[model samples]
Target chain A: MSNTISALPGATYEGAVRVQEMGLCGMISLRGDHGDEKLISAIKDIMGTVMPGQREIVHQDERAAAWMSPDELLLLLPYADVRDALTRLETALAGTHFLAVNVSDARAVFRLHGGSAREVIAKLCPVDMSPGAFGPGQIRRTRMAQIPAAFWMPDEDSVHVVCFRSVAQYAFDLLKQSAHPQAGVGLYA
Target chain B: MMILTCPCCGVTGEETEFHQGGEAHLTRFGPGSSETEFHDYLFSKENPKGVHLERWRHAYGCGKWFIAARNTVTLEVYGTYAAQTTEPPQDIKDTLSAKVPGWSWREFA
Candidate 1:
């Protein structure tokens, strides 16, 4: 049996900011009534945190939950724990009108690190990257150059980006070019 | 370069972040309806120079469809509301009514 691999395992690019592909992180696309008690408790049990607010992301250690929309969420955890987490969610909310599907392989994650992290992302995305406008705990699903992508900051200088696996290479290249040393726009400085 | 605010997620962004879904609040003429009704439903659209209510999807953001009230000529946006609504909200209507005197679109005034 062939071992499962990520779209760009261990891929790294060092420009003004560092871009590294984070391999094989588990992601579950959960859709349901966010106000439902069963769904809330089920997610709390699996993610160890409360459901996030609009465009918010909550994390405890490696487990995290991101509010994707009014009725949807994205759960992030260890790749090996996906099956178990899905089973737990299914069993916990057996009769509820909810959906929990493993989307780990369908997506790719990247970590952007360095002082110019926000500038690199600002060049590609149309979001307000100013410190007061965008900071940690906020997740934005926006167009990254020519593709759809989501990103959140872990701290002041590090950003975590997510995009479809099919566009992993393209997204990486876009980030690489945006992070070129001479390409800094100094908007966020 | 239209700027829109999505009521679903409260994200204000450029038009590139959204996709226009055409006219809003249309009465569907589904199966068993008369041929003319179906044709009008499919082909007919309101092309107003001012104070137009249309459907817009926040395609790159929250992926929710919402209604946008804007002027076609001046590009002035009155407001945006939920797509599930059957009519423009009272405040949006009032805003449009004040800006464009005696403005009425189809059955709305």
Candidate 2:
């Protein structure tokens, strides 16, 4: 045993539409005066890009998205490299008054991938997850699995990252339960 | 089913996640700062024609407390920011100025 947990331990049950997996990925909450040219510059220099691209998947230096405000952005790195990422960025932007909060434990991420995933999410969440309403490369904050979450539906069979980690198992149970009936029981009915 | 439009997440949610922190941009007392001043401080508002920057808690939700700017007249939201921690940016100021003119920056600012 020496395997630290898989950042994404994909959880599954038979005949499920969306893949229910908890990503133990390292998550960071970044806040600062984004208006400060030097601060933004420092971050981009250290991390290559200060802002999450229009899409949910980063493709270049990992993936990220804007959580809400213009001044703040949420940056996610490979679970294992977070400490290194934080320390490097911290020194790089030392005096710029940027704060990097390690929220890996406070929030959990669950990935729901697959075309049937949208239909599965739509059942519990009121937000639009369809290609027409919500498409790839877009991330949105909405209520999901009965918990507040940021939904990043980046593509078909796409990735939907659900945060608020404590609720992950609860959400998993709910999604599993709700989506379960759709897939239906073999002979239990 | 109370629906809260999250500035971060957009207009999609059940009221369960958000906590309403009463009204935003409180009214103040003069230098006199009397008992009635304290009372009025606790209760008063502009509750007016345009955008209002109120505090909302994504309580049961994100557990993060943030402020939301919504227009009372149009019910159109302007923006949101972390509570008590930071001031909004220039774009927000410029947008609000154009949207809600004659706003006393020296006062609520």
Candidate with best TM-score:
1
Clashes of each: 0, 6
Model 2 lDDT per residue over A136-174, tens place: 656666566556667665557655556565666777776
- What DockQ does each candidate score versus the true complex, computed on alpha carbons? 0.89, 0.23
| Model 2 per-residue lDDT at A35 | 73
- Taking all chains together, each candidate's TM-score versus the true structure is 0.98, 0.67
Off by over 4 Å in 1: none
TM-score for model 1? Answer: 0.98
- Residue B49 of model 2: what lDDT? 66
Deviation of model 2 at A98, angstroms = 1.1
Candidate 1 local lDDT, A9-125, one digit each (tens): 899999999999999999999999999999999989988999899999999999999999999999999999999999999999999999999999999999999999999999999
Which number leads on lDDT?
A: 1
